[model samples]
Target: MRYEVWAPSASQVTLHADGRAYPMRREDGGWWRRAAPGTDGTRYGFALDDGPALPDPRARRLPDGPDGLAAVLDPTLSVWRHDWPGRPLPGAVLYELHVGTFTRTGTFEAAAEHLPHLAQLGVTHIELMPVCPFPGTHGWGYDGVAPWAVHEPYGGPGGLVRFVDAAHALGLGVVLDVVHNHLGPSGNHLPAFGPYFTDRHHTPWGAAVNLGEPEVRAYFTNSALAWLRDYRLDGLRLDAIHALTPRAPFLPELSSAVDELSQSLSRPLFLIAESDLNDPLTTTPRSSGGHGLHAQWNDDFHHALHTALTGESQGYYADFAADPAQALAKILRGGFFHDGTYSSFRNRPHGHPLNPSTTPPYRLLAYTQTHDQIGNRAQGDRLSAHLSPGLLACAAALTLCSPFTPMLFMGEEWGARTPWQYFTDHPDPALAEAVRTGRRREFAAHGWPSDAIPDPQSPETRLRSCLDWDEPKREPHARLLAWYRRLIALRRATPALTDPDWSYTALSTDDRTVHFRRGPVHLAVNLSPQPAALALGGTAAIVAAWSPVAPPDGAGVLHLPPETAAVLLAT
Candidate 1:
């Protein structure tokens, strides 16, 4: 076996393997390495200048958590049962889930048991929220320290292999949500090794990654490739790329490296980014002077639909509250409601315009709920707890019928009532207290009561966030699940609904309603408090509806009840 790590700041480095210390030889570019035959479960850590041993930055498995020794296990040794020829971005329905809260066991093997349920829900892709190892135990996963190690509490590296293999067997592709902006405040050992982070730019979490440094860039790029090659992951969702400051060459460079790996693997791979910039160039090809990513999460769509349904008008929601119908219509027509527009919330101009004719609709991933949108709230209430059943169905109809690709938060399909609150298990008392205080302060700014915020260190907080799997088999939950299944089935059956060509899509809006046409399918949603009417020419049939009345006669008019959405197929 061979062991290596990049630790430029250290003059002497040693490998601690199974209670034995061996001096390591320093190699070029701040790397230290040693080769020796070892068994599969060999435990090791690197010691610098006779100090405490630290886990490997690229450790594949941390059986004892982040602060303990890294275990040696080859990914190729895992047995795979299927040869999945990955799915494409267009017309794909993505389901996002967190392993810890996704199942009662909160392990990868247990999560794999639910893959068939997602497949039955008509999900083509499964997007797992960060599985990288963090401190203590459970977390939201964005605060991960070891970028390459799987969370041990959730079954580590072998468990991930099993999960991916099971997903492939079910005809579902897996997209991992990876955080590269900054490491968590506690248990992060990257700084002690070399210049992995820089003070040149600061993000909301902390100092930005040293992306401008060649070695730092190489480290991340290699990690990205390992997910595709070693773990057999189909794609990656880059978390909050907007926070990656000095993004000039790094974004493009990372995209290029992934594209190369995708070609080499002979499998379709995608790179989706969670970007707040609303810049179309994030998905534009590198040859055209852009980042060359496949798609990006469209928060504009979420905000528009969220405000329209809940009528909440705080913070960024204030922008969409004034006219949600207009906001929805703008995104449906041009892919961004705030494109080059004044944002009163930010007190400045935000975003740039996108050409509907040139831009592909699949480049944008639309959703009504996400981890940040729900979990970041003071009470962490899901839309299911707030919105009416009809309104929830209405939101689903619009999301599935939209031209862009669609993603659903873990329990959104069945309207699970569990709140995905921000929970952490930091072992350090000071760090844990700071997290609790910071969470309360942040929500207090949004006018939420500080007393309502859950304690981050409490085990009950983590347990409360787990999904109620039995909910989907009963009452309104069953009905909502049926509605989602029907909408996804319609999306797959209707060619017009899956078309990515934005030029083929059109939109119109009034004070209480919004209507759009994608190919031969027309969608009309009424956001008013009372029944509304819209004109539709020619012969059309109601393909799907939420509290919809009978289709109007040849008089070319349709009436919809309050908060209703309808999809019609034109003959």
Candidate 2:
């Protein structure tokens, strides 16, 4: 087999495979290559001059870990069972799943067993969190070091292939969450090979990825494409594109490449970015001087809904707490609340206004909770921990019924009580201590007792985060799960719920109630602690409700219980 690596800074390079070293000849563009006697499953690494062998930056399989030797994986060896016709983003209900805590086994094979549950839950796509190899056996995966390799603990590349094949067999599309912003602090050796990161810009993790360099840019773009192509993935959720420097060429360039590949594959593949910039340009066309991504996570929507449901106004939640009904109304009508408005959290004007008339509502995803919202909390408590089942159903109704694409974090359908906490298994003791201390310090600054913060390095933290599957079989949880199913079925049945045009969406807010309408469908939500009356524009039939909601009277007034939501079909 041929061995290749990009070591622009190295004077001499050697390929170590099967306990033998072969000198690699330098080629153009700072690449080194040599043919080695190896085949599938061959363990190999590259040595720079007198330095130790380092894993390939583009390694396909790291069997042991990120620091371990890279193993060759022949993509042709695995056979797919389904010839999927492809699922698009227009009407997709995305479910964000973390492989580590998704199942007790924390492996792709085990997670695949639960696909039937998601399929029956009416979600169209399963958005798997990053499976990239990090320093430990388990993590949130944002700290991944090997961008191209799958975590060995989570069934590696082969297991992912099998899982995707299984999902395809069930007519479900799989999208992966990928972190390209910054490599983890530990077990990262990219700097030893070449200048993969530049000091011109800095992110929360320090030096930004060097997108100015041609090869470095290609490195990221190619990695994304390879996942979509090789693994037959339907799409990717790009993590933190706002952190990437020179976003113009890099994002547009990636979108162009992905578009070309999608055409070649004759599939509906796409890129969804997690950006806080609130810039519509993130989803604009390249010809129109925009990045041209398919969709992005709408944290504004989550924040508004969270504050309205829980009335928690800490941190960024403060921006939406003053009048959550108005904030939610703005998001339902337009797309963002901080559209060039002052943000108390950032202490500055943040976000540009989105042209709702021009942009499709489906380009923005609506969710009540996500990994960051749940895991970053002091106790990693989910909404179920604080709110009653009626309110949980209300959140589900608003999100799944909104015109924007809807996404559900894992175990949310059944109101899973497991707290998705910040847990890591870094082998380095100092790094582990730093992570544990930092987590406690962050919550401590928020007035939480240091002892109240869970130890991130503890295995119990991860175990506590795992979904208790039995919850779905019990009371309130079972009822909430039924509500989720009914809401999704209603959305699937109603065209207005999945309508792409933002012009069709409108909302009106009262003191503690909101009446939202998209086309002929109306959603009335009462966030107050007491029962309230909401007036629909016209007489409507009650289609779905979290609590008992009477049909509108002659004046089109809907009586909704507090902390509940009801869907109405306008006549």
Candidate 3:
């Protein structure tokens, strides 16, 4: 087999395999190559001249974590079962999950056991958090070091293949979350090999990746393509594109490459980005002078819904709390609440206006709660812990009834009480200590007592975060699950609910009550502490209602209980 390593920073490179070193020929662009007698499962590392041996930059399998040698993996080894046609954006409902804590076993195969449950829950796609091998046994998967290696703790490469195959057999598409902004602090060896990162640009995590570099761009683009082609993944959820610097050609190039691959595969492959920039150009087509990404996480919609329900005004929630009704209205109608408006949290004018006619509503992924929203909190408490049952149902009604695509965090359907805290298992003592200290300090700034912050290095923290699994069958939990099922079923059956025509959508609010109209369907949510009533424009039938104190009267007047939400069909 011909082995190659990209070490533009080194003048001499060698391939070390099976206790033998072979001097490699340096080609243009600082790539070194050599032929070796190695098949699948061969352990190897690259040595720079007389320097210490380092794993491949694109190691596909790191059986012993990121600090060990790379294992050669053959992509054609796994057998695929189903011919998945892939789900489209308009009707897709995504369920985001972390494999490590998704089930009691925390392995890909163990997580696959629940695929039938998700399929039964009306989920069209299963979005797994980053599975790339990092320094730890378990984590949130954002701080991945080996971008190409399947996480060893989560059943490794073969396990992921099996999980994907199982999901396809159950008629569910898979989407992977990928981190390309920055590598983790531990087990990072890219700097020793090449200029994979740059000190010229700084991100919240650390030095931003050297995305403008041709070789570096190719590395990430290829990784994105491999997931879609090799793993048979239907889509990729790019983590935090707003963090990348010199983002012009890098974002567009990545999008163009993936689009090309999707066409070539004759399948519906998608590229979704998580961004805080609130810029419409992130999802705009490349032909129209935009990046051409298919979709983006609409945090504005999440914040608006969250603030309206929980009355949370801390941090970025302050922006949405200023006028939550208006914010929700803007997001539902135009896809952004702070479009070119002054943001007190950002301390500047944030976001660009999106033309409702040109931008599709499905390009925005709306959610009431996600890993970051729940896990980043001091206690990692879900909205169910704070809001009343009625309010929680209200939040769900707004999220599912909106024109944008809807996503639910794992265990969110039944309002799982487990705290999805940030936990890691870095073997290095110093790195682990740093993580523990940093988490405490970060939350302290948000007014949380240092002692109240959970230690991210604690194994108990991870253990406590596992889903109860029994919660879904209990009262209130079971009811919430049924509500979610009904919402999803209604969305599938009603053409108006699934329609992406934002122009046909309208929003109206009065005090604590907000009314949204999408085609023939109308959603009314009361955020007030007391009961409220709104006059229906015309005769309507109640499609769904939670904790409804009073139904529509003979005069076509709808009465809602405190923190209640109702879905009505225009008659």
Candidate 4:
């Protein structure tokens, strides 16, 4: 219940609480400590020396929005009647969603209306994209300035609390995506206080957050802990950890801090890092001389799968277009394409050697399509707009049945036609224009035409990104929805499809179909125009297939309909 304010620039600091101000003693390294209203849930802010009162960088609970007073919330407060033993993280199916577009009202309470639907979809965990306060109402949330405060439009802190509490009550774990690499451009006023960033360590966005600086580390780490400590969040989906450069002792410091914080938390606090560097040390245990992060986003698996399905070999996808079965084999068993293989895109060998015995297969989170894959496009179009239904189903089946954990974008389940584009509502006119201009140029480097790019500043872009709530009830949308439900149900029910062994899984592809086998699961996908005969795995049991052909094949010889997927089992 105590409050700590890091304001090195200010000479004197006072606790603005209970409609009265009390002086706080300056503690270690410019931090002001006070024992004011530790028992009472009073709202407080740090009044600088003759300057305006500033919100605490490590504010536990915000009651009056980001610009308003901060509150000291006790965890024991407000009855938490729900009690159930915890479940392991390996078997979870995560559904990633943006709070702004998940509902019409877009508040946490509003999002609660869809709980039954999530439960029915077999979504074990719901990963909310960054809810931290940004410049305006809508965004992809990577540009978050006030990392401690929830976005006001999404009903602020109380709404987020309600959402998490509700999710737990429904037996759904909530993982909050947090941005620790850099703050947003417009409303980011952190540097006004002290050296929160350093020029020596620069990210793609301005100077990186000075994690090595005494107070800066406290600010960032404390902000991350707030969600788990106050919001009762189950895990932290760390964003762009490759950019989180700790100047001194980078690996152990950041990883140990996260590991320690997870241990200190009330419930199991899992940390999933979004890292591009395919280093095995990321998920390795601390005792084994590695960072103790629980898991990391598997972009290699995505790139491999994406290139194989679409055959659009450009940018990073250049390394993965040789064979469809390569992706099918790597993602199904080992988890990544760059498993010490020579990466032509990087012009050198990338990724360290992974220990099959030491490294757990579940340390990677895989997906065929996601918000980044959809939104990063010039037109903000989903894969459904580009690929055939059969190819799309092939990609979906691989993601769901793969050994590594699977995560779905908001509308990905039902094949929602509406796009999850990269949209931002930056109130500043100059900042908005800069963003639009920057985005266009960024895409141009990757061979995208300038004229084809959508302006990020335009209202049309944001409107286009909104989930068409009615897409679920329509023709192709309804069909895709049923397909996803059946696939997910099979994934949950079938033990063969859930096997996690990168080395053991095998794939064989010809002009006819792609054969994938992981343990007892055998998925034969017919990609040709004609009715391609599927050669099932020798040891696999017949569980299910997409019924690839029109009429069912008798004699226990499955007839795969054209462009359909057959999920089978080895008995």
Each candidate's root-mean-square deviation in Å?
1.4, 1.2, 1.4, 3.0
* Per-residue alpha-carbon lDDT of candidate 2 for residues 1-571, written as tens digits (9 for 90 to 100): 8899999989999999988999999999999999989878999999998789999999999998988899988988978888987899999999999999998789999999999999999999999999999988888999999989999999989999999999999989999999888998888889999989999999999898998888888999999999999999999999999999867688999999999999999999999999999998999877777888999999999999999888889889999999998898888878999999999999999999886655789999999999999988899999999888878888898899888999999999999988999999999999999998988888889999999999999999999999998889999888899999999999999998888777644578876788888888998888788999876768889888888877898998888888898988888
lDDT values, one for every candidate: 0.88, 0.91, 0.88, 0.74
Candidate 3 local lDDT, 1-571, one digit each (tens): 9999898878898898877899999998888999998878888999997887788989999988888889889887877777877776778999998999998789999899889889889989999999998886888888798888899989898999999999999989999999989888888999999888889999997888998799999999999999889999999999999898878898899989988988898889888999999888898899898899989999999998888887789889999887788888878888998899999998999999886665789999999999999898988889988877778888888888888999999998988888888898888998888888998999888788999998888888899889988999898899998989888888889988878677654578865788877777888889898988887777778888887445578887888888888888888
Each candidate structure's count of clashing pairs: 0, 0, 0, 17
Residue 419 displacement in candidate 2 (angstroms): 0.8
TM-score of each: 0.97, 0.98, 0.98, 0.90
Report the lDDT of model 3 for residue 152.
90
Q: How well does candidate 4 match the true structure in TM-score terms?
A: 0.90
Better of 2 and 3 by lDDT: 2
296-319: candidate 4 lDDT, tens digit per residue: 899988887777667778878888
Once model 2 is optimally superposed onto the true structure by TM-score, how far is the C-alpha of residue 77 displaced, in angstroms? 0.2
Model 3 TM-score (2 dp): 0.98
